[model samples]
Every structure is written in C-alpha cells, then in structure tokens.
Target: MATGLDANGAELFTLELARFNGQVVLRSVLRDANGLAERSAWFAIDPAQTAIEFAWQAAGTDAANGYLRLAVGSAFQVSGDRREPARLSGLRVLQQQGVAWVSLIGTGN
Candidate 1:
C-alpha cells in the first residue's frame, strides 16, 4: 500500500517501481481521477536541482526513475517508463478543506 499527501489531503498511488529493460515512453491516458497540474513536478533521481524533489521510491538506475522529466500537469499518463519509454500512470489531485491540493503520484503499469 502506497501513501501520499499534498497541501490537499491523503491519497493512494503506485509507489514501488521495479527495474526494467528498454524505454517505455507513454503516449496515452488511462485514468487520471485526480488532476495533478499546477501542483506537482517530476525530477531525476540520484541527483538533480535541489529545488526539484525526487521521491526516494523513484530513485535507482531505472531510467524512468533517473533524470527529472516533466510536471504531471493536468495529464496523468503520458509517456515514461523504466527501461524503455513506457506508459506512466497513477496521477491525481487530493482535495482537502476548501482547496484542491497539489498532486504527487507514481507511474506504474
């Protein structure tokens, strides 16, 4: 079970990612119940701009978890994988109080 929370509320998403082989760039959208735009951002692992925060779960040698990519924005599943560019999923916005908080989800298929 994966856990996540933004300025909004708590939510669940794919956090544990496995090593892959080739590039798995995403080119479609499956489900984005929570819009993640204007909130979160994608970053590289191992290292990147301190300003950009990469989840420890997204660390390692996996390409998908390597370099920082793009903000998940309104689009959830776009194009991103471990080995080869695959499909990136699990992105949404957790609402709380009277504000739509930021989104921080994983990309797992």
Candidate 2:
C-alpha cells in the first residue's frame, strides 16, 4: 500500500503500520490538516520491527496512546499511548527520500 493525499492533507490514505521493519530512518511530524508541524518524532527500524494497530490496547496499563502513532526501535521505543485525538488545528506532512517512507498521524478526537 502507498500514500494518497486528497487536498491540503484533509483526506489522507496510507499504509498504516504500528511497527516498521524497512531499516529506514523514519522522520515524523504531527499537525492538523493545515500542513503545520508543531512537534517531531523519530523512529528507527531494521526489518524486524513489530507492527500493531493504533486502536490496539496492551493487556496492562501500559497501553499505547490512541491519539499518536507509536514507534519501537532496536534499543529505544516510542509509544503513542497518550490519549485519543483531542485537539485539531492543522495537519502535518513528513517525508524522506522524496516520497519513500511510512507514517501514521493522529487526527482528533
């Protein structure tokens, strides 16, 4: 699967992966549907990353955030188990290698 942007990043479609194993340096940023990055995220994978669904919850209280896209590296791990999308002012668009990468951004609650 690939990415498809309708307009101004409003309607978006992409291959959502909870984990990555493509061995690529994934550069991520989050915003609303207005193309603005207020924060940044970084993830590194090797071809064995564990992918999961954003709506997935852990068996314990350490469940991932439902409003953010989580990433787990070989030695470091980033989880999006913050909360459901609660705010919306704009959107973010992150890319590496011109158009080769994977990303999952939260919209809003």
Candidate 3:
C-alpha cells in the first residue's frame, strides 16, 4: 500500500495492491477526514507494461471526474475535473526488494 499526499503533506488517497478472484489489481481510494471512502476505483495492473492509466468517479456522479497515469521510474501524470484533481505526483521508492516495495507519492523530484 502507498499513501498519496499533497504538497503540504496531507493525506489525500491510498493506493493498494490486492488479489481478487486470483488476479492482482490496484485499488485507489480517496477518503474523507473521517476515513470514509469518497471515491474509488480499481485498475488491472500488467506486469509486462511499464504504466497503467485509469479513470474514476463518485458513486452518484454522471461521469468520471478523475484520471491518473502511473509509470514505473517516472512521475505520475494526472488530469481531470478541477475540483477532483489528483494533487499528488511522482513516486519515491523508500525500500525495495524484488517484487515487493515500500513507496510514497508526491515526494520525488
């Protein structure tokens, strides 16, 4: 799991990897101050690819208002509605060994 933060170091969202139906997927969750999920989405991660792109919206929303592109060894690229912009970018690999890693978002140059 990885916690994404804003420029001021406030928690904005969490990205986690989990197995569902025997397949690994990435889960992105945006939580409110009380830790309630505000919006969330799941994206399939392909180990053969260097990047993954996804879009999401709130439960009652008419359209997707959030988009994110994450690439290994590169900064995160995000774009979408102004009110729901992903304030975090970049990834810092704090620790890594083989396929496992500990990382932080928005902490890299």
The candidate scoring highest on TM-score is: 3
lDDT of 3 at 83: 40
* Candidate 3, residue 50: lDDT: 53
Candidate 3 Cα errors over 4 Å, as ranges? 32-35, 52-86, 89-109
Clashes of 3: 0
Q: What TM-score, computed on C-alpha atoms, does each candidate reach? A: 0.20, 0.32, 0.47
Q: Model 1 over residues 14-52: C-alpha lDDT tens digits?
A: 222222343222221211234432223332222122221
| Position 3, candidate 3: lDDT | 61
Candidate 3: worst-modelled 10 consecutive residues by lDDT? 52-61
For residues 1-109, write the lDDT of model 3, one tens digit per residue: 5566666565556566677897666666665545576444555565345544333322224444545344433424343342443355433332445543542222332
Q: What is the Cα-based lDDT of residue 43 in candidate 3?
A: 51
Tally clashes: model 1: 19
lDDT of 3 at 72: 38
Ranking by TM-score: 3, 2, 1
Please rank every candidate by lDDT, starting with the best: 3, 2, 1
- Residue 36 CA displacement from its true place in model 2, Å: 1.2
Model 1: CA > 4 A from native: 1-81, 84-86, 103-109
